[model samples]
Target: MSSLSKLAYYLLHNHSRIAANLVEQGIKEMNIKIPDEEKDHAVCVYETFFQFMGDSLEQETNEIPSKLIEWSKKNAEGQIFSGGKISEIIIRYPVTRKIFADLSTQWAEEFSLTNKESIKILQKMNAMLDVSEVETVFAFEKLTKQMKKDYQKELDTLSNPIVPLKEGIAVLPLVGTIDSYRVNHLMEKVIPEIAHLNLNYVIVDFSGVQTFDETTASYLQQIGSVLRLLGIRTILTGISPQLAQIAVAIGAEFHDVTSYTNVKQALENI
Candidate 1:
């Protein structure tokens, strides 16, 4: 192995011990009031960066840094699941990089390396640190997107509910305003539920829904069509005058679907 590679390997092999000590030093240097769990996370973060740096030097390849950046994005996601914030690493990286860079300089001095060789190692260390900053931010954004989707799914489940009125009869009372997301989720959820329940008729009560746009009127038409194909009849109730006007404005015709004034009226008819 090359001399630089050997040095890097030696540093990596002692990384855990060095990181444990560095955590205390870093806390003092940063002067941040962090919890015990955060201290442990700091140790882990330091170890990961040390391992990445060691591999960069050991492999002597231009691609390892890029690969490490990709891997850190996934790593950041996992860390979020474990209650570690991306901001923690972002806030602490400057100090951590300085400590590691100083350690590398000390190593260079030990090897009797000249000024030019020392500068090259410092340059590589700074570049890796830069890559880390970008990757951590990207990972945080990925986590945010995942969280948003999960929240939307939960909202979909909450807003769309199928309550069985009797054998082969059900009521779907939609709450709040209609958006494209809720409309899509309703079709996705209600279609399978109707088939599974063997429902012949469903009373769609929109009394709680405050408003809907032209797109929502289109979705209602589509839902009626899908229910007809599945051999389940949909009876829509609670068409306020404003909603009726919107339906007319949008030129939506629901000739195939039945309409009622309210759920009670629809139930009485059945």
Candidate 2:
């Protein structure tokens, strides 16, 4: 089918649902609407918006452009509620499209990047497309940033050696989410830091960490074991009840891992 014909078919079948969902989301985010006179512009934008989302279903999860997020935020802040219905239609279509694209990419690759997994992820994305755009965007932004930070941290850990420290101690302050990628990064950094500083203790502070899953907790458990092998002590700090639950769920036992409630507390114990 021709692109235009396919788009028209989609709109004919899905416009009401799309428009109502997007408008409601925009209202919650910034209190906006589409004016009756500007409905044509809104429809045009929505059509373009759907095309973008459809295309994104096939892309990699970590490839969202930051420009889209900035532009959507700008549109919402400037015209969510005040530009009448014209603003509603004009702004929401693009904003919703970006959100759809972000969620589509995230869900599509949360497990694997194969075709089968991608299709399942797409279904989940469609379900969430009706949620608030503002909240969705917020989560997308936060998650993407954490992913990027984890990536950069890995690169840094691999390329650089730890600086020497006195008192045979080194501290690595961890903020945000922790995943397998981050666990590998920490492992790289810790070994080199231990060798370079000749340190017997390495403290990892989870004070700013928002979430920790099984992979991360298991990584922590392994780190403690590895450090003991090297005759170094691993100190874990900032263990929240939620993280504790995750640790248990993952069968990650910290019984052998030296842990504390916070960095300060860990230091005192050290």
Candidate 3:
């Protein structure tokens, strides 16, 4: 290992407690509160810093591995479990990175390092922070996808409602595009909700739906058949000409399902 890496390894390993204390100070400088739910999480954050710097200094090339990126991701996942907000990673930690960088320069200067040594120390410090920042973003993006999926599922349940109008009668209004995801939700979530409603008659209104693919149209046709097997009578409403054409083109068997022009007309006529 280089002289610089050796010096770093000595400081990080022998003086780990001091380094961890400095990390906590840097975090406090950001004014980011460590909530009670995530109390132990604060310790993990500092411990992660110690491990990363110590391990990087131990390595010969001064280069961190890709799997070592998991170090950052694991810390982030801990934050979630510990009640640390995602904003802490995105907003607060950038400030902490700057603080840690400043501390590294001060330490190098205090050690009376030459200009060459000082530059090498800063370079190593920058390299470590760069990896952490990049990996943290990847972990945050994963959290965002999971969070969005859950929110969308809630919104879907709200938007595609199964409203009970009267005894043994319910209306399900489908709006917007019908994709495979929506089809699966209909069969899974909506079907169960329909069953729980204990309605003998269900009015599946499609007037608000703008478009649907062949697969979606075929799935829609199956809704009536599935309900009929459960002894519920399903009357389809708001069949736009485009939807009708798509249904016919897909060779979907809709002969057994009854159709009405609109929800209002279906309610009045049925």
Per-residue lDDT tens digits of candidate 2, residues 102-153?
A: 6446534443355655555455444433333554456445655666787787
Query: Whose lDDT is higher: candidate 1's or candidate 3's?
Result: 1
Q: What order do you get sorting by lDDT, best first?
A: 1, 3, 2
| Model 1 Cα lDDT, one tens digit per residue, 143-232 | 878989998888878878899999889999989988888888888887788778898899999888888888888888888888888898
What local distance difference test score does each model get?
0.79, 0.58, 0.73
| Candidate 3 CA-lDDT value | 0.73
Backbone clash pairs for candidate 1 read: none
lDDT of 3 by residue, 21-131 (tens): 665675577765665444444445555555655676566457665544775787677766666766667675567667666766776766655677666656766676687
Question: Which candidate's lDDT is highest?
Answer: 1
Task: Kindly report which residue stretches of model 2 are placed more than 4 angstroms away from their true locations once superposed.
Answer: 1-166
Among all windows of 10 consecutive residues in model 2, the one with the lowest summed lDDT is: 58-67
* lDDT score of residue 33 within candidate 1: 74
- Candidate 1: list runs displaced more than 4 Å: 1-18, 35-41, 44-75, 82-85, 98-115
TM-scores of the candidates are 0.71, 0.41, 0.62
Ranking by TM-score: 1, 3, 2
